[model samples]
Structures are given as structure tokens and as C-alpha cells.
Target: MSVILHLFIAILSLIVLLLFDYVRKIQFYKHAAKIPGPKALPIVGNALRFIGKDSSAAHDILLDIAERYASPCRLWLGNKLFVGIYEPEQLKTLLTSPKSMEKASLCSLLRPWLGNSLLIAPVPIWRAHRKLIQPAFNPQTLRTFVHIFDKHSKSLVQKMEEELEGGEFQVGSYMISYSLNVALESTMGISETSDSKMYTRYTECVNRTMELIMVRGLRLWLHPDIIFNLTKMSKEFYKCITWMHTTAHSAYDTVAVSLQYIMLMLASYPDVQEKLYQELKHIYGKVIPENLSVATEDLKKMKYTERVIQESMRLFPTVPFLTRKVVQDLEIGGYTLPQGSTAFISVIKVHRDEKYWPDPLKFDPDRFLPEEVAKRNPNCYMPFSIGPRNCIGSTYAMMEMKTVVAKILLKYVLKKEKIQPILTIKQRVEIVAHPVEPITIEIVKRLPNTFNT
Candidate 1:
């Protein structure tokens, strides 16, 4: 009876201490509490609402909340507060701010997979690495990748020809393979013949790793390394990390998903594809059988083709969201975002905002024409993000995208698979925005006479 009484008293004391700590932390976010947002529940706060949902669903919920409160809204995940910014003005202030250089704490989930690479590195380390790597993406260096892009793209076309038997097939897998090939060759000089089996294993591992990370992120109980490692999923996760490190670092999902969107958009709109093909034909002046290589000079002249790619990205930005942790207290839109606040920039919402994009859902490539682009806010469309810490490989990625797309367009006329409604592909956010369903398309062999090589 005496031991039981003592144990009860100890438990009561611990509960009291925990409550005091919770209140102290809540006071720390008093400034954020004044900001507009949904009313959070006590203790668990808003986290309980997102406990079982996938990242994509959770992302959609946040987007909806943003719409309800508009930009500069606060979200509470348990006791932690996140500010969601969608307005161009707020985005400009947040993105350009030097103090907001470090990635948010949530990005730590990516550490297991990406390691301490450029994508998730903190500000100081990122700066040093960015300076060292910037030269590799210069115009001269990127020009060398044009040939590699062309080769792999042609290889992609051949693979598609052999694989797609007129019926609808998912282009996502093939695009991933093509992008992986380009990334390996350009970054590590790994040719296709170097280790085909290893490449296959690496791709499989990457897919598994991403799926595991996304699922784990939503489960609060799995946040701790010890608990996560004990699970069966961690076994595969570590295995993937080993394979990834053995080869070069992993490629971003944006590269593959961007290609998927471009293909889907072109297929959905044949008129746009025809115009793009005509521009390509005018540049190449009839596709040569033996010489499918596109020069950098010729690729530069593809204004309309570039516009199509840009518009595709605008409609479906591969990276739908970007986040940053505030290193210093900042003020925006008559509200103070205290230091340690996480800022969530909704790229999807910003790109689709009717204020910046008239008839925002329409796929109009002409929106990218210099005159139209000049009329809009510079911060409105940022598929690759903006400011100093933006993607280092943006220029290289664009050139590669254009090269591969132009090559594919030169050989095939892409048409929608007709089994699904046009533009009905559902999107899911798993690190990068990807279609929840298979983006199926039918490819007709065009320029058969030029294919005798």
C-alpha cells in the first residue's frame, strides 16, 4: 500500500512537470499564436488530424487551409508552428531574405536518404558547395551534356518503341530510366554499359526509400531514429542508402516527373505538339537517319519548344512546395514571423493563383512569350525556385529537358491514351509532385523514312 501510494505521487508530479513545459513552449510561440490560422486542439494540436493520411493528402489539406485564410497563414503541427505563404509579395520577402537560408526541421527526414548533399545542406555548408559546383553548370559545361541528353533521349525512344506495343503504357517508369541515365552520365560519367544491373537496383531502392520516408514522416511515433531503425522498413532504407552511395548520389524526382508532365501535356494537346514538331523540323530541316544529334546552337533557336516546356512546368510544377526555416525574426504583411518559424511556400498555389495567371488552369504555351512574361510578377512562376539558394542545375536541367523532349518529338507524335479523361491525372506529393495514377500515352511513329538508321 505504501509503494502504490508513492508511485501514484511520482506519476502525478511527472504530469505536472510535463504540463509546465508545454505551457512554456506555447508561450514561446505567442507571436505566432496571434497570426491567423485554424484553431488547434489542446495537447495533440493539429497533428492528430494528419496522423493517418499520406503526405499528398496532408499537403492538400494545408493547401485548403491556405485558401481559407489566404496567404501568410499559420499552421500548428502539435506545438510547432508553420507559416504558409502564397502571395507573390510574401514569397518575394521570404525567398529573398538572407536570414531564411536554412531548410526547415521537417527536411531532416530526407537526411537518411539524401545524406548531407546540396539539396538539404544547411546555409554555410550549402554556400561553400554551391560555389564549388556552380561552374559545372555553366553554359560551356552544359553544352557538353546536350550530346549526352540527345543520346539517352534517342535511347529512350528506342526503348519505348520496343516496350510500348500500341496499347497505353505508363511513361513514368521510362522517363525515370532516361533521367537516371542522363544524371549518371553527366554527374559521374557512368555510361549505360558500366553496370546496368546496379543501376536497376539503385532505381528500385530509391523508389522504396522515398515511399518509406513519406509514410514515416506522417507517423509521429516514427520520428525518432531508434524507433524507426527497429522497424523492418529501415532495413530496406539502409540498403538503398548503401547502393545510392556506391553509385553517385540519387537524382531528384523533379527531373523524371517534369518529363512525364511535358509528355502528358503534349499528348493531351495534339495541336501544341504539332506546332512544337514543326518548330523542331524547321530547326533540323528534316530529321537525318544517322545524325540525330542536336547542337546547342540549334537547340537555342527552339523558342516555341522552350515555351511549351515552360508552360508545362507552370501548369504542373514538379516541386509543388518549398520550405525554409527562419534564422532571424522577420516581418511580412503586417505580421511578425519570429525566429525559428518554418515558412512553407506553396509553389502550386502561387503558380495557379488567378491573380497572376489569367485562366490559370489553361495550358497556354504562349503565356511564356517574353511580352507576356514581362507583364507578370517575376516571383509568380518559380518551377526551379528563385534567389541565391535556388537550384544550381536549373540551366543544365532545362537544356537537358529541351534536348530530350525535342529528340522525342522529332521521332514520335504523342497522343493521349483515350482510356482516361484528358487532364484527369491526380497528383500526389512525395518529396516531388508526381501523378497518383499512371500517365498513359500512345506514341505513333512519325518520320518513319528518317528512322532507317
Candidate 2:
């Protein structure tokens, strides 16, 4: 009798609390009603839509919703309102807005692992940290990181030799490993060790925690701290972030994922690969690629290679979306994003949109050339995001990617005999987009005399 009474009391209290919440948010609900969205249900809203899906499927569903409606469309993840911003102009406005600095509620999922880091820090904190961190990614500082980038590239080449004779292997592991090491060495000043134990732990923890974060974000019921604390994923998440690499994980992880995609794209397009190689040969004639000393000047001269990197980012942007909570009423297209709603700026939408990119699905490095780029809207390309809160390390990331690719392509010819087309490659997006399957390719060793010194 006593247990039954206590249970009844708990249930009654929950109902009362929910009713109170509903009564207080009458305006949010009213605003959401006017906006168009996927079919939403009473009380639960559209939260049920994601019940059985994983992150990859969740991403697809989100895209479908974005496509079905025009820009600044509506979505209800439970009681919360999300306005999907698909148009480039709208994204540019929201991304650049001073008032739209607040991160969306879903960012709370990353708070524990990231711990008030710049990525999720309050606007004030982000501003302060950005000031301090901005210098590290400047061209001058990033230029200094070239040797470390080249050293790691050489190490990656040697590590990949085992795959030379073997069948197609998932090259992501090797590539990500190299990227993390560069991220750590260049950004964190954590010197590389022969064993790579720390690198493995860092990589695993990042992937695990990010995967869980996306899962929890879509499953609105798991939003509550009290309930989420009980799940196994929550425990694993804490263990991953707390185990090692306390902060700077997001920085390094983003760097790594972008590099992975670029490498895969280069392998997929042999014609582009050869053109890039020719450019490298033009600059460094008759030199040994395995031990080629990469200079900042050399990197600057590789314009075609830079174009390849840019095109790769367009096809599969590493950070697919950037989210912000509307502070004041944000106007996008004809719709108004209620002050409290989320601005889901979909990078994928603009990137893949045929309006901005004719035959957008095709991989063409020439699309980035100065003459061609002049013809398009400036807002159409933003792999590193835009505005005041853009990535601080964009320059650094480019320098490192260019260095690594320069070295690798100098030493090996990347190829895949039976490979899927670039656009058709499957992906799962966590903090960054990851190909569901491994990015694998064979590397044919280039002779020492191919490039003249």
C-alpha cells in the first residue's frame, strides 16, 4: 500500500510539472504552429520521428525535411523548435548576426566532453578565447608547423607501406592517426612517440563520445540529465572525455576528419591526382619525395592542390552544419525564427545545392579557380564556416593538409581499382562527417627521379 501510494504521487507530480511547462511555453508552441514542418504529434511533437534511427539515418531524415520545405523550415524535436536554414543567403545572415551568438540547446550534449571550450563556450568566453587563440592559426605561425606536418606525412607514407601489397584496406585509420598526431603536435605541442598509444586513445575517445552525442541529441527523451545519467552511453562518454586529452579534442578531431575526406577524394579522381602531381613536379624537380623537404613557398605554389582540397570540402564538408539559438526574432526568407528557436544552418544544403554548384554532385577542382569562383555567390562556399565565430585554425588546417598531401602524392600514386563514386560514398556525421565505410586506396611508389630538383 505504501509503495503504490509513493508511485502514484511521483506520477501525479510529473504530470503537474509537464502541465506547468506547457502552460509557460504557450507562445513557443503557438509560433511553431504557424511554421511549416514534418507532421508533428500532440504532446510529443515530432520527436517520435527519430525513435529507431541511428545518427547516419537521422542526418538523412534531417536532409529530407530540409529538402521538402524551403529555407528556414520548421522541425520539432519534442517540444523544442528547430528552424532549418537551407538557403545560402539565410545561413550567411544568421551566421554573421551579432545577436545569433547563442549556441543551440543541443550543444549541451557536447558540454560535458568539451567542457566550456571555445566551440561551446558562452559568447563571452568564446570571444575571450578567440582573441587568445587567433594568433596560433595565423599564416606565420602555421608556416612554422610545416616541418611537423612533413615529418608526419613521411611517417604516414612508411606506415602505409604495409598496405602496398595487401588488398584494399580501410585507410581512414592510417590517415586519421596521422591527422591526430599532427593536430596534437602542432596545436597542443604534444610530441609524437613511436608507439602512438596516446593517439589511438585520443582517436577512439573522440569517435565514441561524438557518436553518442549525436544519438542523444536526436533522442529527445534522453535530453534530461537525470535520465541520461543512467544510460551506458553516458558512462562511456564521461570515461572517454575524462580518460585523456582533456580539451583540444574538438580542434584536433575536426582537423583529422577533413584530411580524411580530402585524401579519399584525391584517390577517387586519378586525373586530378596526376594534375596535382605535375604541379608538385614542376616546383620540385628530380627530388626524392619520401624525404622531400616541404617549404611554405612550395605549399603556396601548389594552387591546383589547394583547389582539390577546396572541392573535397564542398562535396563532403567536415562540419556539416552550424547551429545557433535565435535571441531576437530572426527573419529568414519569409519566415520568422521565434526568438527562442534554433537556427539549423545546413552547410550541406548550400554545398550540394545545384543553384550554386552546377552538377554539384560532380568532383571538379576547377570549380574553385579565381575566374570560376568570381561567377558565384561568396556565401556558397564555407567549409570552415563564416563570420566572427568562424574556425580560428582554418589557415593552420589548410597548411597542414597541403603539406601532407604534397608529401604523400610526391611519394605515392593513390588509386582504387573497384571503388564507389565520390558522391555515393556513405557517411555518418558526429561532430564531423565520417564515411560509414573506410576510405581505402592503394599507393604506387613514385620513382625518386620523376620530379627534378
TM-score of candidate 2 relative to the true fold = 0.92
Q: Which model scores highest in TM-score?
A: 2
What tens-digit string does per-residue lDDT give for candidate 1 at 110-154? 897676778899888888988898888888888888888888888
In candidate 2, what are the lDDT values of residues 127-234, reduced to their tens digit? 998888887777787778899998888888888887776756777777777887787787678776666676677777888888988988888778899999999988
Off by over 4 Å in 1: 1-19, 22-27, 163-165, 194-200, 419-423, 448-453
- lDDT (Cα, 0-100) at 192 in candidate 2: 66
In Å, residue 354's CA in model 2 sits off its true spot by 0.4
lDDT of each: 0.81, 0.81
Q: Give candidate 2's error at residue 396 in angstroms.
A: 0.5
TM-score of each: 0.92, 0.92
